[model samples]
Target: EDRLLPLSVEISEIEALGGPLLLHSWREGIDDVDNDGEADEWEYSIMREITPMKENGTVKIDFPSLELVANGEFGKVSLYITGTDLAGHPVLNGGAPGVDNDMATLVTQDDLPTTISQPSISLDRWGNNLLVGQIHEFSFSLTDDNGIGSIDNISIALAPGDSRGDIWLDPLSRELSVNDNSPIHPVGLVIDELAAGSYKVKIQFRLGVDSPQSWNTSTQKPSVIVTEHGQVLELGSNSLSHLEWTVDGRVNLMLLSADDLSPPHSELFGNTLYLQPDDRFNFSGQLHHPANGLNVILDGDWQVNFSMDDNQNNAENWYTILSDSSSFMATSEIPQSRWNHGSATVQATIVGGVQTIPITDMKLHIVIDSTPPQLDFPVTTLSTINSNQMMQQLVTIRVNEAGGMGQNPLELHWSFRRHGVEISNMHGAAQLPLATDAEGLWTYSTRIDFDVNSDLLLPGDDLVIWVVGADLAGHPLEGIGTEGNSKMTQLRVIYFQPVLSELTVSPYQPTIESVFTIDGRVLNEGNDMGVVKVGLWAWQSSGNGGRYHILNETNLTLLPQQHAFFTFSQEAWDSGDLQLYIAINDDDTNLTSVPVGLVREQTTGEILWQNIDSPAAVGLMILLISVVLMVVTAAIRRSDEEWDDMDEEEIPPPPPWAPDEWPEGAGPPPEILTQSTSLLEEE
Candidate 1:
């Protein structure tokens, strides 16, 4: 048999067969169906009485199933209908074993999708607030069709358009490089140690096949919100979200009264504030109250108010100062009874929620010292400083101690007064440094200078300045005006400042024996006229430091801006630098000069320095030359005397008479002739 006979049975009856129905299947080649090595044969089983066929003549059989993990070989599978209740049943065989009818395609989970789009990026924490020095971490969560390749960049900037910040970063991939084979998609941002302020965070992303510009964030949501550590800071992606940070320390502030609108804070007083009439001021600085425990708000805005009493006698006239809530004024309204009179006291109380705190030692006492403040100045010390800096008027003002940094009620209010009123706008109200004394009084001192339009001071017209002793509150020191020791007013005598100009030497670099002229003009740089001396002087830089003489001078009275010229002549001196100088108004006082120098004489001159025109130096040279000439003349006379001695005279007499032997015959005749001539000459 071929083992391929056709078989048919009732579909309903065959499906009821729950037992295993064996098929007579056989293979030609070896197939390890059971996973064991060798090939095996199938056992043939009987036929079954199945249900009858339907209209299409298709029989259905319910065959019990068995699960198998064997790998079937590509061999033939046959079925035969044998003896049974329903005989001649043919069981058909399939073309091949272990083959699926419908083909399947491979699918990968990580591969990029057909259509690419932008990734949705965001932070894990929605809250973005933090402490000033605290470090925190958040994530840049991203989701896309191709997954995240990398984060291109991230940056932080101050909110409200402040670009000066610390959070600028590039390629914030957070180790998400393609080469490392590590799964890096979500980028984490770790913020550490930020200055307390409002800041914003932004970022860009890199996805496969898409540039950062092409990435889409139309569907991104704001998630991160940072808070609790300090101020509330919100963190959002794709858009701007700011972080509000605050420091942990407390803050300081100051508030003045109604009249003084500008807050002096620590500029005037340490812990207390001084107020004048109609003064209105404000307080602006860091403020904080220590937290009692966890979950307590340390930074609380409290309602503060100022109260004052008419007298230190503990009277019942305490009144609240009425002021604008936005102003730095500690009080809303100051009762006239407190500040209008002297010797009044004031304090401030703060109401923070249910807690009330009264700060003490913030005393405001009225001042009433009848005597004006005394001004002391060492005239000699002040005169040496640059008069031009003092506006050509020497003035050293020291307000008598008003309790040093802490001005008590008895302090002096020293100021420049004009037209019977204090000139508060002197150089735009300059702030001077404070000096502390042993008596615990603080004083302020300064120099006044009005550079322009100083022609205001006429002759003998005193520049009036006032020094009044008063408390911070409006009371002035009262005293009888004394003639010489008047405490309240000081009159400075303005002297005309003589400024020497046009200072020059005719021959700038003078040669030896050459005459040079020193010319200068004196101009009164000050307001009034005074007697000023203009002089020409020279410094011989020959090992002399201060030894210089004024060769010429002229005393003259110069009015303001009026000038006069004085000139002098002198012969050039010294080969080295000759300091030729001219000055005005420097007689018997600190000298100032415009000096010119002459190069030292080298070739035309000798080694020593000399006013080449000076007769003493020339005479010394002539005397030495004369002495050398006299010595040479004496030597010549001695030589002449020696030459005369060497000459031979007609030494005839001795020789003719004494010679007897060699020229015996001629000797007698020569001797007779010599004796005859000698006798004749003698006679």
Candidate 2:
């Protein structure tokens, strides 16, 4: 072991090295701080004192200046001593307290490296896949260096694992050299050679050492997926996670699983699927097949990968397949033909089973020519309809046969007649415009005027407007005999004849009940034939010889000069002379006929309704008389008995006494009581 040497620094020299050096004695109570955990300002001044070597080269030296070192930090002091002419001696060897060597320097550095980071990895699905030559693409990124620095060549080895697919590169570079150091590596990725089956594609980036500070990333790897042909599909609108496409006919489909080593399992989106016999590139459009047709399968929800390769030389062609099972690819070379209808089969691959859905036999007939004709209304009824009451409202008629309803060459001829009279003599064929609907649908309205008199009324003359139209083939789809054009309506017309409809009597007859049947008829002179109901009236002459009294009414319906009989209760009146008045009215026609006189058949009942009163009176009189007679007889009998009780003499004597009692001067002779003399003589 070598002897210890004393180190010191001159105060002036300390100031030269950036700043003053801190120095302090090794003694106790050398508190350089205010006790506030911080060095006092004065402590800084003490640092200016850099100790030097003592008298001799050999001396006892202590590094007491260490106290001036910063707190919570370490301080290092190197010793550089210059020996005076004398050689430096070992301490305790009769040397001075300090020995100076050469100069000393201290250096420090802040913020040293501590921790290292690992890059992150991510994965996502490329869009959908194509049917035959489909390309499976994936995007990859990383956060940590693989081995030593940023990865450069990303060599992806996609082994179908168990899937079957031919990897393909479509016009783009397959070997991705991501050494450009962009924030986002390889903006795009495309995987070719995809087959039907589950796959485990291993992706590794060839790491390149770009900088001495670059980290090694040889161990970091990315993940990619390539689905099979028919097993995978994409539903354009639905967010289905899994989709399976089933093929039909001479073709079959197989599901190719994603690379097993890939981070995320491969999924087939079903909602993005669009299967049509038409172009596969256009997904959100209607597909029409003239020949082999198209088919589509809608799997509920299940991840399915597909693979297919077919060269059917039919009109139907196969477009791209979707990523999920919800949609599939149709591989047909059939073009749009002139078939009335075509059919196709759509198959869906499901977890538990598979579905084969058949398309329509053929698409609907689409009229390609959209040329529509214009329609004007010289006589056409306005879209706004109004209620009219006057003679059948006569709306003028006009039609431009040329520019009518469709692009196909067509002609129209029309004729109008009112009340069986053809009125087209004035303005026969008024030219009109084409239909208003852009679709070119034929346009005709119920706007005919039969009566020339009333604008607010429907023509009453049984007006008829005849229309005749013919196609380019001379196939007339109009006219009276046309399958669909002949229509008829009654113009402002009326039932000219009148028929008695109803005639009824009040209270029915009381004593003699009778019902009379009145038959009558009327002629129908109107252009339109219809039923007319007419009412009749009857009046009877009172027995008092006064004017005739109304009795009852009858009604009947007459059909064009036809007659009818109406009968009502004749029991309403007694037999008497009655005048018959016939009134006929057509309710629907709103026309009333004049009252006509009809011969009255006399109805007679000798026993008027009042006969009931006479019988009742006779009965009451007989009962009164009987009662009075019985009372009178009882009184007479009583009186006779009383008389018998009294003597006859008493009665006679009472009468003579009254005569003699007459005033004395009034009677010259008084009749004597002869009853007593006669009784004496007889005795």
The lDDT of each candidate is: 0.38, 0.31
Q: Judge candidate 2 against the unseen true structure and give its global Cα lDDT, from 0 to 1.
A: 0.31
Per-residue lDDT tens digits for candidate 2, residues 1-683, read 12122334332221212221333222112333454433333333232332343232322333433432232223222222322222322112111211122133232222122111112122222222112112223323322211211111222222122111112222122444432331112223433222322112223221111111111111112222222211221212121223212112111232222111111111212222111122222112112222232322222333322222122223332234343533333332212342122233222322322222222221111111112122233423322223233223333323233322332322323334555565545223322333343332454433333233333233343333344443221223433422254334333333244434444443222223334444334555433345544444444346786442334444433455554555433332444434445544423234332232222333344344345348886787799999999999999999999888885647553444555467776756665655445766888
Off by over 4 Å in 1: 1-129, 132-139, 144-270, 276-330, 333-398, 401-683
Whose TM-score is greatest here?
Answer: 1
TM-score of each model, in listed order? 0.26, 0.23
lDDT of 2 at 155: 29
Total backbone clashes of candidate 1, pairs 3 or more residues apart or in separate chains: 55
RMSD after CA superposition, every candidate: 30.1, 29.2
Clashes of 2: 154
**Candidate 2 accuracy as TM-score:** 0.23
